[model samples]
Target: MRAYLATSIGVACTAVLVLPLSLPAGALAASPAAPPSGRDAGVRTGPGAHSAAAAVPGSTESVPLRPLGSTRAPGGIAEQGVAAREVRPFSLVGVVWDDADDELRGTVQVRTRAVGSHVWSDWLEVETHNQEHGADPGTQERDSGTVRGSTAPLWVGDSDGVELRVRAAEEEDETGPVRPLLPRGLRLELVDPGEEPEALPYPPSQNSPETRPGAESGTATGAESGTATGTPVSLGTGVSPASGTMTGELAGPAAMSAEDRASSAANEGLTELGAAEIPALTKAAVAAQQPDVAAKAYAAPRPRIITRKGWGANESLREKRFGYTSTVKAAFVHHSATGNNYTCKQSPSVLRGIYRYHVKSSGWRDIGYNFAVDKCGNIYEGRAGGVAKPVLGAHTLGFNTNTTGIAVLGSYGGTNPPAAATTAVAKLTAWKLGLHGRNPRAKVTLTSGGSGKYGKGARVSLNTISGHRDGFRTDCPGSRLYGKLGTVRTSAARYQGR
Candidate 1:
């Protein structure tokens, strides 16, 4: 993908950032400072020595799958996977291959041993047809030459031992049963989200601003005072040229990378540099920014959203620059399919794991979705440009150009989605869609960029708010959750004053 340099803020495009690649213990700082009691407590603090695992940067272990031999299956199973064995601690797993264009026409199942325990769990299925969510087939991001085919990541909590299998589907032929060919380069990926980073302080202060082309007159952008008046400002120690605030790690050139500055600058209008979360805005506050839309009574109150920083994202893990599309025409909803075994308290860890999987394991530039919601109704920023901007996402394959993706954490194929989760989806869509003057209840036609269900340039009409299955032939946003789209649309429209 084309990387947008932070030249606007004086960040040199050629700056090199050297980072460590060691897989430290407690690599994913995943656990909360104080985990909740009961079942969740056990998940974070498993019985035995693992309870005190040190927090450190996360790591990935990719093991090749091998044939299990004739003794394993009745039909001489046409399968490939690793036998049960102990290894480093990891909380998520998936299968990936070298070719992004090749599809895995088979089933993937994995079983695991809980960290520090000998008990082995039953085999759990992984989503094999997850290629429906990716960059458009021929975009620079899709053709970045590093993309790969991967299954939906499965969260298995803390585990040190794993057994996995990938079985090809058998079909009846004239001679007998025949098995289809499996994709090449099949490997099981074990992911450790690593230790969660320390939470940044709330109400983050803007960092010290650097010299800009037009700022020699002491005048600053409206990011600080909400209006770009020619106000004279003093530039000194701990003083921001835009807003005289304390200079922190995020603003100091020595402390921040060029990528970090660009990311923070993208959200300058909505938050201060290095802010953890974007504060919720009342309808009046939102209306004040758009008087015309307010006069038309067609705006939704901005929802509170947790920034990537709030979720402890290691920005260094992703590509150094950002990508963007022209506008957000629709919102495609999805279910993480990572299972519902986690508590709201562990949501950040979940996000971090997924982020790491999408980048390091799946061979993507960043997390596929634009936003993520927890079962408890918390909203988080997904891809790193700007929440309000049309940040090009690796979601909805052919439809990634002008649409945003919102994934509610957890699988919903059999289980019903929580009311809070659906409600948060509605609230988020209402505000984000309103920004582009889209009516969640309206229908819009989008041209396909080449997906399994549609060819490039094929025009299809769909809801402004639709499920992941709407654009592809996969069971995403599951049946139970997909059924809730109607309610989400109605609620979002109402919130937008439609």
Candidate 2:
């Protein structure tokens, strides 16, 4: 395949809901309450310690919520004055809520203590708008019928006890609710992220896709994720040499087999310069040197994509390998939900922060979104794998198969996402989705990969360019950015010359 210049690139829970849910007698006490039993907190575990099979590392549990407090944050500041009881050795923890119609009008934070250790890690904020947590959208997880909306998970090494607190944001509508915005149906997750079985080589011997099954939180491990009608699971892109920028495999990290490509090039006795060396030609220069190529350029409004290397993504850090899915059937848009406190120049640092958080802190293989855009609307690649490949993502639950995840960096609740950011969404969708013969404005039906909303194998109709909320029950892409979907679809259509 000739490389096109444009770039790219959970949990389980057995119906734990059926278990007896007891919130304890003290739903609201000014002082902290005693930690409840796993069953009392609505988690359905049998009596006695977990069985050896159940102890298989990285298994998950979904404990239902009761409510922490009715008091609002003093003077409206983010704080973690509350904490949950000791959980199992599941390395990851994320918060989940019930309603998509409502917003999580606050900031949530968590800290965990490693098993057998009393040391407490520093508090870290959980991405709040992540309601779409569960299985991949079109796989057996979705087809098997189990997924849900959840907060981005926090990776705390090996730990048994977890702590969580929400600093309810002051309501924009003072008349809304004098009490802080406490999201409903809160659940804490303890995931094992079981080891993945290897798959066949798509190209050279790259590592097999160790995808998690139902990672709807957009924060996940192998086989434990989804793609969205909007954007399900997502990651950051660090190495993308194919687009004439960055180092590593030309096919992007996911499909890159560096040694093989290098050997083939060496055999031909040609030294390949990086994309930076051979600059993308100017329109006039393109015509002067290669009239045929320039003529083609004028044939359509080409989407100018930024390369991962262009954004200072460090490729050396990613493992030398690639993972791929079959094809991209949909595009899910999301917001990093990491708050807006960055400049365009600081974008690289922001991406790095997210990358480390996902990999080192969250215990994910890599950052989640396939592509990420900045407030300035610059697009960066996410996850491993080629940006062009279906490379499954852990963005949306029960809907990762045959889909792509594109995330805009920053939260967009009350404040609107920059026009530049949403515009990038349109441009990215136009070029990528166009490759698959998808109409950005058209409606498509995706088989439920799995979720709390539907049965296994349920077919779902969704806009080709959808919101994160459309997948599970997330407020991702945020309310303000989500509202701009109509604009995104319209703009994408125009880019595709719809």
Candidate 3:
């Protein structure tokens, strides 16, 4: 009889051979000095005699039988027997980070061992999914000593649990030459493993559950849960045992007010202000305007009302602009300060001013941007549509060489631009993206010429519009207006239908 053992650590695996004891026939023979009981000789035997006979073979049998303890049967000696082997246990290690649900998510490492072998095969499968009902399973191969997985872009609830499984080919199988053993390990780790949990913003109406915590029985609407009463509710922020309307010390940016959340979403292009909310937001922008703020709006020279001077009103200008032929691979956004405290009606003059600045100050022959938007959200022609002919402008450094640029009025860096402004940016961005056959939400970056500052290139998306600071080194737009670039970008993306 023999036994085997295996062990593993990190990438190294090893196995050891365990020797078993050999029992002789003579050792199992009954002792001659012991008196034979009646039962021992097929007669009425006492308990002592029966015990001795059980431990030793009788004279009638030439070979004595011995009990095997935690040992495998001898090879080539077939008989009904059992064998026990000790194999090394496998281990998994990894780190988790905050996911969309305010839950913790991360990667994991996996390894296994076999009896009597030092080499481990990379033949393992890994999968992960939320423990909640109706969750999809994500699968991956164990590559380069690690397995990675991620959750969906929404909260998976308080009991967000993950399961992992492992399988290997078995040693023997009569049906085939080999069989596979199914051994699995389930790790129920908290997504947010930090000692102090952070708060997560409520999911959007599209992805949020419909029912509020205290609502009576009702049907769930897609990701959102609906209550008997007509209101919908979001899962409480962060992962915890308590379930109800979220209230307590807020943590992280998730604690922001509804206005702040709306601002953030608008900047990110994740959501647009509702139509009803747009008017109020516009009024707020008008009221929020500070008189002391630099009023450089009327600094630029106004365009002549003759023949073809203003945007769409000029027929000769349209004839001069080129048609859209070259692929518009990227886009750049800017702000115009030509008309101080101007309304949407002044959009034409604003476009003319931008066109002049690009030609006169930047040495560009035409307006740099493809489009321009006013404070009231009116979209005007700049390069592509202002004239019939294409007019390339020098806008983004290295990037604008073949990119399209769009300019909006007023400085967004200081305060949140009006809803109208954001809406116009979104519509214009979406239209341009559709015309150019590009994704509005896709990220754009300047690959050459500009300094590595701002992460080596100006990385932006079509959905989230930007001011001049996002790419070029100079502050073409004032600092107050430039500060809100991210918010504007987000808001624009949301409007782009992302």
Best by lDDT: 1
Provide the RMSD of all predictions against the true structure, rounded to 1 decimal. Answer: 14.5, 16.7, 32.0
State in Å the error of residue 373, model 2: 0.8
User: lDDT (0-100) at residue 27 of candidate 3?
Assistant: 32
lDDT value, candidate 1, whole model: 0.68
Give the alpha carbon lDDT tens digit for every residue of 1-498 in model 1.
101111111222211122232223234323323432221121212111133333336767777778866523334446888876667788888888888788776678887767765466556777785578788876666777777889888777888877788988776678787776677788888888877657742332221122211223123243332222222222111112221111122332447664356444356567664667665554434545553443235556556677887777766566655677766789999988787767676788889889878876676777999999988788889997778767778878888878899998887776688887898888889878877778889999998888888888999999999998888887888888999999999888877766
Over the stretch 190-229, how does candidate 2's per-residue lDDT look in tens digits?
Answer: 5544332132111211111111111112132322211111
lDDT of 2 at 131: 32
Ten-residue stretch with the least lDDT total in model 1: 1-10
Q: Which model is ahead, 1 or 2, in terms of TM-score?
A: 1
Q: How accurate is candidate 2 locally (lDDT)?
A: 0.48
State the weakest 10-residue window (summed lDDT) of model 3: 298-307
Estimate TM-scores for all models. Answer: 0.77, 0.50, 0.32
Supply the TM-score for candidate 3. Answer: 0.32
**What tens-digit string does per-residue lDDT give for candidate 3 at 81-108?**
1112111121111111122112121112
Error of 1 at 422 (Å): 0.4
